[model samples]
Target: MEEHNIFSLIADNLSQFYEYTGFANATFGHILMILIGLAFVYLAIKKEWEPMLLVPIGFGIIIGNIPLFPGLSVGVYEEGSVLNILYQGVQQGYYPPLIFLGIGAMTDFSALISNPKLMLIGAAAQFGIFGAYGIALALGFTPAEAGAIGIIGGADGPTAIFLSSRLAPDLVGAIAVSAYSYMALVPVIQPPIMRLLTTKKERLIKMKSPRAVSKKEKIMFPIIGFLLTAFIVPSGLPLLGMLFFGNLLKESGVTRRLAETARGPLIDTVTILIGLTVGCSTQADKFLQWTSIKIFILGFLSFVIATAAGVLFVKFFNLFLKKGNKINPLIGNAGVSAVPDSARISNNIGLEYDKTNYLLMHAMGPNVAGVIGSAVAAGILLGFLS
Candidate 1:
C-alpha cells in the first residue's frame, strides 16, 4: 500500500506539471507571433520608429501570445479579462476620437489656412483609399472589409482602427498595425516615390511665401470646417466633431488649460492604451491568416498610390503656372496623412537639391489637409460600405 501511494503521488505531480506548462499546448503560430512582436520592440528601441507607440504595442503583442490553458478566463479575448476590458475602448471605437482631440489641440492650421489651394493636394491623395477599396474588392473582400482596408491608404492609424472596428472587427488588429507601421516608415517609403515622380527642376522649384492668414479666419476655420464636413459626411461626426472641438479649444485663445491637457497628458495616456490594446488584439490564431497578409500588402500599395497621386497632382498643377509661381512638387508627397513626418520628409529631400528652399511650411499646408481629407474619405467609405 505504501508503494502504491508513492506511485500515485508521483503521477499526480507530473500531471500538474504538464498542465502548467504553456509549451505543452503552444503552436508554431504562437512562437512566430512572439518573434514578430520582439521584432517590433527591436525596431522601436534600435530604430526609434514611433517608440512611444511601438514599444507598448510590441510588448502587448508578447503578452497577447502567451499560451494559456483551455477555458482560462484571463486571456485578452476572454470576456471578463482585464485586457478585454481595456480592449473595449478599441472595439467600441472610443480611442480614435480622443486621439483626434489631441491631434487637433496640437496641430496648427496656419499653414493650411495660408495656402488653401494646397488643400486640393490632400483631397487628391485620398485617391489611394478608393484605389485600395477597388483592389480589395477584386481580391474578394466584402465591401465592408474592403472599406476598412482602404482606409490604410490614408496612413492614419486611428481612423483605420475606428473604421475597422465599425466595419470589420476581425481585422482591427491587422489594419491598425499596417496603418501605423506604414505611417512610421513614411520617412523611408515616401522619399523614393517623391524622387521617382518629380524632376530635379520640379524639386528645386521655389514658391513665394504663403499669404498671411487673419486671426478671424483661423478662428472660423474649425467652426466652418466642422460644419461643412459634418453636414456632408455625418458618419464622420464622432471624429470630426472632437477634432474641431479640440482645435476650437486651442485656437479660441481662452481654453489654454483644456488645450494643454488634451494635447499633452490626455493624448499620451490614450496613445498608450490604444497601442497596447491594438497589439494585444493580434493573437496568433486570429492574426496569422492570409487575410491579414493581404491587408498588409494592400496597405503598402495604397500608400504608394496616394503618394504618387499627390506628386502627380502637383506636377499637373505646374503645367499652367508661371515659373516663379510654380509650387515644389516635393511638398506634394506630404499629402499623405502622415502629418509632420511626411512634411518633414519632403523638407529633408528638398534640401538635398536646394538647401536655401524652405519647404516645411509649404509642406504643412497639404500635410494638415491630408488629415481632413482622410477623415472625410473614411466617412464616405463608412457611408457606402456600412
Candidate 2:
C-alpha cells in the first residue's frame, strides 16, 4: 500500500510540472521577452512615447506573460482567451478601418485642396516605404513581412496597422508600436534630417499665401480624392475609403452629428480597445526576438529616408517654380503624417527663421498628402504580397 501511494504521488507531481511549463520548458527567451515588454511600458509612461498607446501595450505584455493562465496562453487561438479575442480583430483588419473613420472625421483637407501641387510632395515622401521594404527584404524577411515593415515609414499608425494586420498579422504589435512611437517622436526625429538636408537660407524661404478654398470645393475634395485613390489602388480602399469618408463627414456640413460622433465617442472607444489589444499582443516570447530589434532599427531608418526624400523633393520642385512661388523647405518635413503636430513643428521652425513666416497652412498640404501616400504605398505592397 505504501509503495503504491508513492507512485501515485510522483505521477501527480510530474503532471503538474508539465502543465505549468507549457509545451517547451520555461527558458531565458521567455524571461527576456517579459523584460522587453516592461521596457516598452516604461518608455510609454516615463518617456511619454505615445502614453495612450504605450501604457496599454505595456500592461498587455505583462498580462500575456502570466504563464499557463489557461485562456491567456501564448499563441493559443482558442475562443475566450485574451489574445485570441484581440488577434481576431487584428487578423481580420477590423480595428484600423474603424479607427480610420474617426481619423477621417478629424482630418481637415482644406490646405491640400488649396495647393494640389503639395500632393506631389506627399507622394514623394513615400519613397521611404519602398526604400524600407527593399532593405527589409535584403535583411531576410519574406516579401509579405517586408511589406508590412516598410509601411512604418509612412508614419501613419492606422495605415501601418491595416497593412500589418492583413499581410503579417504576427508582426502587427511591433510594427504598430514602432510606427506610432516614431510618429510621436517626429518632433525629435525629423528636425535633424531637415536641417542636414536644407540650408538655413532655404528654411527661411517664405512660401506664397494659399488661396482660400470655397465650401463647395471642400465638399468635393473628399469625393474626388477617394475616387482617384480607389481607382488607382484598390488595395488601399480600406484605408483611403475610411479616411475620405471621415473627411466627407467633416466637410459635408449635413453630417455634423455624425462627424461629432466619429471624432469624439467613436475615436475614444476604439483607441482604448486598440491600444489595449496592441499591448496585449506584445508578449515576452514574441517580442524579445532578434527580429523585433531589426524592426525598430529599420523603422527609424525609414523615417530618416522619408524625411530626406521630402526635403529633396521640395528643393527639386523649387528649381522649376518661379522664385516668388517657392515653398520653405522646412515645411517639407511635415510631409510625415504625424498629424497637426508635424505641421506645427515646421511652422515653429520657420518662425525661428522669419517670425512672420506662417508655414502651418503650407506644411499641412504635405502633411495630409503623407497620409494618402502611406496608404497608397500600403496598397502597392498589398498588391504585390496579398
- The TM-score, computed over Cα atoms with residue i paired to residue i, of candidate 1 is 0.96
Q: Write the per-residue lDDT of candidate 2 for residues 216-306, one digit (tens) a residue.
A: 9999988998999999999889888998999899999999999999989998877777776776676666777889899999999899888
TM-scores of the candidates in the order shown = 0.96, 0.89
Best by TM-score: 1
Give residue 20's lDDT in candidate 1 (0 to 100). 63
| lDDT on C-alpha atoms for all candidate structures | 0.91, 0.83
**Candidate 1 local accuracy as lDDT?**
0.91
**lDDT of candidate 1 at residue 97, scale 0 to 100:** 95
Query: For residues 1-386, what per-residue lDDT tens digits would candidate 1 score against the true structure?
Result: 99999999999999988886778778899899889889999999999998888898888898888888856777789998899999999999999999999999999899889878899999999998989999999999999999999999998889999999999999999999899889888988899999999889788888889888887888899999999999999999988998889999999999999999999999999999999999999999999999999999999999999999999999998888787778899988888888789999989998999989889999999999999999999898888888
Pairs clashing within candidate 1: none
- List where candidate 1 sits over 4 angstroms from the true fold: 1-7, 10-14
